[model samples]
Target: MPKQMNFIVSKNSFEEFGMMVILGTTGAAMETQMNFFFTFWGIFQLKKGYKPGVAGMPFPFKKLGGAMFRKMLKGFGYDDMWEMVKDGVEEGKIKLYPCSMTMDLMRVKKKQLREICEEPVGAAAFLEMCDNADAVISL
Candidate 1:
């Protein structure tokens, strides 16, 4: 059987989230089954029309720096984060799930989430899915 990988995403920063997409897609390309569970601030990434922006820099200049950093990344031939995520989904390379507990706590409606999100599940359920995974990574 192929390997299974589970990724837990709790950060909303662009760089961190982008890495998750990159790793997940790459794992899929390697014939691994990749599952991503988005929780806490990470759930925002699954919001409808959410755009990727650089974050996690010093407070005063985080937004500005992020924009410049993203522009620089584009110049280097990187696709927009959202586009990369969509591509992965289209290729049947990923399964995306939103954290049900976070959804309830944050009052995020299912309809407000992007179509790419397969379902909303609690931490217990997410852990169960990862139980047999060859590797479970948190980011």
Candidate 2:
């Protein structure tokens, strides 16, 4: 009976998608309940020890492009969605999960994701959370 819901975002945008996730989650936290399941392209941003460009390529052939894109974000004052989600967690009304299967496929270890994620769960488990949600969105 949560007032709000869970969102599943699977696309990779030029940080635009990332923007939406941050906005949506922040909105939910302010007014309703919320959870986010990051899968596929979404998982790239959820990696624990993962730093966007300092590590490996989160996106294919877009390393330099991605870095420059993030620099642009700095000017916009775009905040890190992961850290925002963490704040939501500390406030006790949010949960963020990094898809377990996606991690395996990408060769991303659990230890690598634990730092930022509330937990690493399967899609089905995530759907279970969605079941009672007022909305379940995939972007």
Model 2 CA RMSD to the hidden true structure, in angstroms: 4.3
What residue runs in model 1 are displaced by over 4 Å at the alpha carbon?
52-55
Query: Which residue runs does candidate 2 get wrong by more than 4 Å?
Result: 12-17, 49-65, 78-81
**Per-residue CA lDDT of candidate 1, range 38-75, in tens?**
89888987888765556666777766776787788789
User: Candidate 1 lDDT (Cα, whole model)?
Assistant: 0.82
Clashes found in each candidate (C-alpha, N, C closer than 3 A):
0, 0
TM-score of every model versus the real structure: 0.89, 0.71
State in Å the error of residue 67, model 1. 1.7
**What digit string (tens of lDDT, one per residue) describes model 2 on residues 39-127?**
88777666554444422345564557666766786688867655656676766677677888888877877776646467789978987
| Residue pairs with backbone overlap in model 2 | none
